[model samples]
Target chain A: SCYLIPNKMVPGDSNKECTDLKGNKHPLNSRWQTENCDECDCLEKEISCCSLVAIPVGYDKDNCQKIFKQEDCKYIVVEKKDPNKTCDVSQWI
Target chain B: SCYLIPNKMVPGDSNKECTDLKGNKHPLNSRWQTENCDECDCLEKEISCCSLVAIPVGYDKDNCQKIFKQEDCKYIVVEKKDPNKTCDVSQWI
Candidate 1:
């Protein structure tokens, strides 16, 4: 079985604190949340993960960059959480 | 910064070998394949990691299972890899 880890950040004190001039507080700490829980700060970078089986692996933890490609390596299955994307939950089973 | 690892599997020898009558060969090593490289095998367990910022956290590698919930924890936003889903590549920013 396989699943996802939606990495996201949240404000300390539950956003109770005030924000800076840019309307952004000192965002801190990142934890694993519930199912598809995407209600926090965006990832610190732009990242994508394609089905490794379909594409070549591009992983750089130093840069925190991961890219996933299509099976034939012709196209990139940009994993942007789109309805037509290829992130089938059935794969988890 | 954050990124994704498309966990997949591929045939040991690039799927060149044949399979049993059940169409199942002896699945071996699990390596990090291409972008969203979903070819070789699954993650062995059912795991889910939500935006801890928006929801609670649940991580159990022993059971190989993870679950993510909604902000209010009322609904279960199943991470099925759908376009309508909330996975934004920009989050990696």
Candidate 2:
């Protein structure tokens, strides 16, 4: 599974380039880009990224929490169903 | 005014508490919560937070970038208007 690795956990040189899940190389200190299910950015050696999922409304909060929770990552309510206002996690690029 | 202060920049005690925009105090390490237009979390002395705003789907990316850009912050497409597929920043807690 593709996920973000924090700069502190990154070993070796701080300026080392980063490889996305697709094996695409991103230079150091570059803005985040989506790779597979993750959207990530690199700053120095630290990288911050969030997983992308298209969840429907009425999804269990606990389940969503469990599915999306990871070290240094968070699962937020990024979208909601219209009119009904159910939780949604669509839109990733 | 209420924004995250990174742990490294925090002076003196490392376990100092955080104050939200509404003057509510959070412990040293706590999950993020919304205060006004910001959603913030504290880890040690470093705080990570994002400003919140409702934007339409057709909202110009450049304009949105200019409006929400801040030091240590990046504006993302967190939500979109359903049906019409407009940008929305609703649902803050």
Candidate 3:
């Protein structure tokens, strides 16, 4: 879901554009994906973001690791010692 | 991805089971889905939870609303004024 990151109150700016945490400005009503894979909206007073990827968790952390698939915007659980081997992921969030 | 919610440091307890925030005890290595749709794992020191559903965001919030489908563990963007009409979802997290 979307979570709003409130903008630092600027004394007189009531514009619809938004400024992200990185200090990058985006035009009003614009939508973009961050470098960290969060889809964000440029609102009037806040920057709203939602994760674009679902992370796989609840796996055997001792033997498995989660890897991000940048192309698909999701994660895969695999054997830590062998990337080619898949691991059982109990859940994703 | 998994987010750890550390349990209160209870003195003298080193058990393998975990006590959730709701005070529910779960055995170590056991995984369960919470009523809120989060998939959690019972670890020794903390409860690790992952969201099982990808929430739709970046939609026209002023005109559309999100509806959760429990059976499918996903969300649908629909017209706020008319649930029967589908809305365009800009992204899902």
Question: Could you say which candidate leads in DockQ?
Answer: 1
Candidate 2 CAPRI classification by DockQ = incorrect
lDDT of 2 by residue, A26-83 (tens): 7777766441234677756445565454323344444232122222343344222221
Range of the 10 consecutive residues with the lowest summed lDDT in candidate 3 chain A: A1-10
Work out the TM-score per prediction: 0.16, 0.25, 0.49
Q: List the residue pairs that clash in candidate 2.
A: A7-A45, A32-A40, A57-A87, B7-B45, B7-B46, B56-B87, B57-B86, B57-B87, B81-B86
- Can you rank all candidates by TM-score, best first? 3, 2, 1
Between prediction 1 and prediction 3, the one with superior lDDT is 3
**Model 1 segments beyond 4 Å from truth?**
A1-26, A29-67, A70-93, B1-28, B31-93
* Candidate that beats the other on TM-score, 1 or 3, i.e. the better one: 3
Per DockQ, what order, best first?
1, 3, 2
Each prediction's RMSD over C-alphas, in Å, is: 18.0, 14.2, 10.9
Error of 2 at A17 (Å): 1.7
Instruction: Please give the lDDT score at residue B35 for candidate 3.
Output: 46
Q: Candidate 1, overall lDDT?
A: 0.28
Q: Show model 2 residue runs off by greater than 4 Å.
A: A1-3, A6-12, A35-37, A52-54, A57-93, B1-93
